[model samples]
Target: MSVRALVVDPSAPAAVRLGEVPDPVPAPGQVVVEVSHASLNYGDLNDARSGRVPVGAVLGSDAAGVVVRAAADGTGPAVGTRVVALASGAFAERVAIDTGAIAEVPEGLDLAKAVALPVAGVAALRSLRAAGSGPGRTVLITGASGGVGRFAVQLAARAGAHVIASVGSTARGEGLAELGADEVLVGLEGLERPVDVVIDSVGGSQLVAAWHLLAPGGSVQSVGWTSGEPAVFPPYATVGPAKSLTSFVIEGGAGPDLAVLAGLAAEGALTVEIGWQGAWDRFTEAAEALRGRRVSGKAVLEVSREERRAPALLPQG
Candidate 1:
């Protein structure tokens, strides 16, 4: 059996298109998921354009759907359970993932909202936690209008940190105050008060600016270099670690973290803002919007029923 999936055609100058491919089968500790909705991340966009994802390889690592096949090993979620997973070929109609890659989507949350929790939501939680944000502390989040940035802002605020949200344009700053941002800056300029911590997603100049504004004993947790440029800092900047800067990628096996985020989202303590919601076939438009920074929050793509409602392969004994 074959399924429809979004693949990168390296031979076609890295074109992204939907193609029919073989169905995914679960390994010993893995289960097969019927993807219903997926979120577009900055990483996926970069991978598609760089042509480094390999020719004919399915793209995307974020997806929320139903598990139709339980692991043969009898471990992990049971069949018919809805989950959000870090499946590499998530852009496809179905994907096989291990227990480490999935978390049950919380009650009262739809698949689309669930899709936002795995990568972007988990990144936000981890980044804020890394900053050690807590009561009476101040945290600044770069690219606050973006997917991870939005989550970081909310999570930081929830942790009792004074949250400062930064965006490329003032227009993007609207309603951020409601999201618990004490301040919203169009740019890093006029930063009268330094922050205790910084969650930087916009690298390059933005990261440089955030680093410069870090308060003594403060730290910056760097993630997502959406600027697509290298960040350079002065040699004197690293003199004596009064301030610390650490870069990290979102690692897998964060299912518990995703579950926490899902609960917060379901309770309205955290908001999952989907800036652009459309059919999966509109992936090109969503990708362009994300790459151009035209989206204020996350862009969610709804896979068609024809894809997600495929017949289950697992047979009842």
Candidate 2:
């Protein structure tokens, strides 16, 4: 079966193009999902422009789809269940995903909105958890306007921490305030009080500067390196005496926590800022928007509704 998908052709010098590709089939322990919606992240833009994976590689990591096939073993999703799945190559009409990688969409949640939660949501959850975010703790977040940063701010604040958000521009600063950040600072230099936890998504000199804002026995969770520079730690600094630094990388097995985030979205405790929306044909445009930092929230690529369904095959025991 031929299905429409975003194809990044190596031979074509132009940007990514939407074209028909062969539909994926379910393999053992895997199910073919009919994709409903997919969202863009920084990694997608990098992979599309750099051809890091392959020229024709499908470029999406977060998607909400319907399970069409289940492994015979029934270890994964059954047929006809709505789910939010995390995997690579989600830019296509159908994606064959491992059962373990998928999470059943929470009741009464918009699947399109759910697409924005997995990657950024899980990262925010893990980052806050690593930072020891909780009641009475003061959490500082850098790049509070970006996708991961925005989610971090909301999650940290919901955890009862006093959120101090830092954005590069005043426009973004305004939006961060609505996302529950207690205080919004335009730049790293605006931070006046030391925080118990810091979530640093903007690396480089910013990371170095944020390190100084950590309170004694405070923790900093480093997640992204968007600044194109390495983080530098000073010697015998205040960080040495009372600060702890850690890094968060979102891998598989975060489904349980992601489900919690999905539940929060259902309850309206979490808000997903939609920065840009485009059809599959405008994949390049969406990617460019992300690369230029023009988008404040997650960028989404709308796929065909026909792609949403449960697979026919079941996992074998």
Candidate 3:
């Protein structure tokens, strides 16, 4: 049997289209989940045409849903459990997710909001931990208006760090201070204080500016490059105090971190801000808004049960 999904279509406006693909058969350690909501990330847009995710393949990373078939190994959630997953090919009516990659959504947490936590939330949590975030440290999060940036700001503040949220414009800096940011700035201008840790998403010249402001022994976690611009360091730029720039990617079973985030959201400790939400059929509209930076936080698509009826064959891009 085939299933309806959003597949990569280079010809389409966002290089994706509503198409069909083969149904996923779960392995012994995998559970089949009927996806109810999926979150969109900036990287997903690049995946469509960057050859990272092949054309015509189902494209997505974050999904929240109910488990229709429990794992044969009895390792993860049982059938009928609501769960969120950070897995491949999640933009579908149903998905086969490995037990290690999923976390059960706590009571009172909406699946649509849980869907927003996997990619951006995990990155923020892990990156902060890796950067040694704690009380007395100063954490500066670049691209503070976007999903990852917003999450980082909250997580860092909760960790007792003095948080500085930097965005592209003053208009984009709204509500960051209320989210626990000690300071909010439009870009990195007029910032002379050294930062103990840096969670940088807006690469390019902004990264260069942030690098110069790093304190001794500070760590710069290069989480993302939404700017899509080059970072050209001047001569002797790297010859300053001992600071490190570490590239980052989510590379392990995310179940534990996802659980922490979901529990926080359930208790109202963590907020999930969804900027754009609509039916899965309107993926093009969502993608366009995300690419244009019109969406503030996360973009979520609601998958309907009626769309599970698959066509005879998958469409080619």
Candidate 4:
């Protein structure tokens, strides 16, 4: 049997389209989840065209769903459990995810919102920790209106850091103060103080400026490159004190971190801001909105309704 998925299509307008692929078959340590929702990331857009995901391959990394088949090894959640996972090829009707990468979604959190927690949430959590976020530290988050940026701002504040959010415009910087930003700047302008930690998503020239504004021994966790431009530094740019700009990527099993984020969201500590959400069939619209920066936080696509029952499977002797 085959299942529907958003596959990479180099010729399509968004380099992806709804298509059929073989139904997922779970491995001993993997469970088959019937996807309820999937979250889109800026990296997914580039993956479609940059050949990182390959033509005709399913393209997505974050999804929330119900496990239809438990792992044969009895490692993951039991069948019928709702979960969110950071798994590749997640934009499908069903996905086979390793137990280590899937987390049970707590009650009261919408699957659509839970779906937004994987890529963006984990990146924020990990990046902040890597940069040593805590009280008395000033954390600057670039691209503060985007998915990762919003999460970083809130997490940084919750960590007791003085959060400085930098956005492209004042309009995009709205509602950030309430989210725990001590200061929100339209650009890097009107800012005189050097920050101790910089979670920079907008690479290129903004990264260059952020480097200059880094306090001695400060750290810049390079998360995403939404700017799509080159970061040309002056001759003496990197000749300063002991500062670091470390590149970041979400690595390892994300289930534990995802659970933490879901728990926080359920308890009202973290807010999952979905800038756009709709049926998966409208993926093109969602992609365009995200690409044009019309979506502020996250873009989620509903893949299916909640299913309480898993399809009947053959019994083992």
Best by TM-score: 4
Query: Which of candidates 1 and 3 is the stronger one according to lDDT?
Result: 3
Q: Candidate 1: what lDDT? A: 0.84
Q: For each candidate, what TM-score against the reference?
A: 0.94, 0.89, 0.96, 0.96
lDDT of 4 at 15: 92
lDDT of 1 by residue, 1-317 (tens): 89888898754432688788898767788888888898888888778768668778899989988888888888789888989987677898888888887899878988888898777888888887777999999999989999998888888888888999999888988778989999998988789777899999889988887888888899999887878788788887767658888987777687778888888888888888888989888888998888888887899988875544554756633
Candidate closer to the true structure by TM-score (higher is better), 3 or 4: 4
Deviation from native of the Cα of residue 57 in model 3, angstroms: 0.7
* lDDT by candidate, in order shown: 0.84, 0.79, 0.91, 0.92
Global CA lDDT of candidate 4, please?
Answer: 0.92
Ranked by TM-score, the better of candidates 1 and 4 is: 4
RMSD of each: 1.8, 2.9, 4.0, 1.8
For residues 1-317, what per-residue lDDT tens digits would candidate 4 score against the true structure? 88889999988989999899998877789988888899999989999999999898999999898888888897989888899999999999888899999999999999989999999999999999999999999999999999999999999999999999999988899889999999999879988888999999999999999999999999999999999999999998899689999999999999999999999998999998999998888889999999898898999998844432444442321
Over 4 Å off, model 3? 305-317
lDDT value, residue 234 of candidate 3: 98
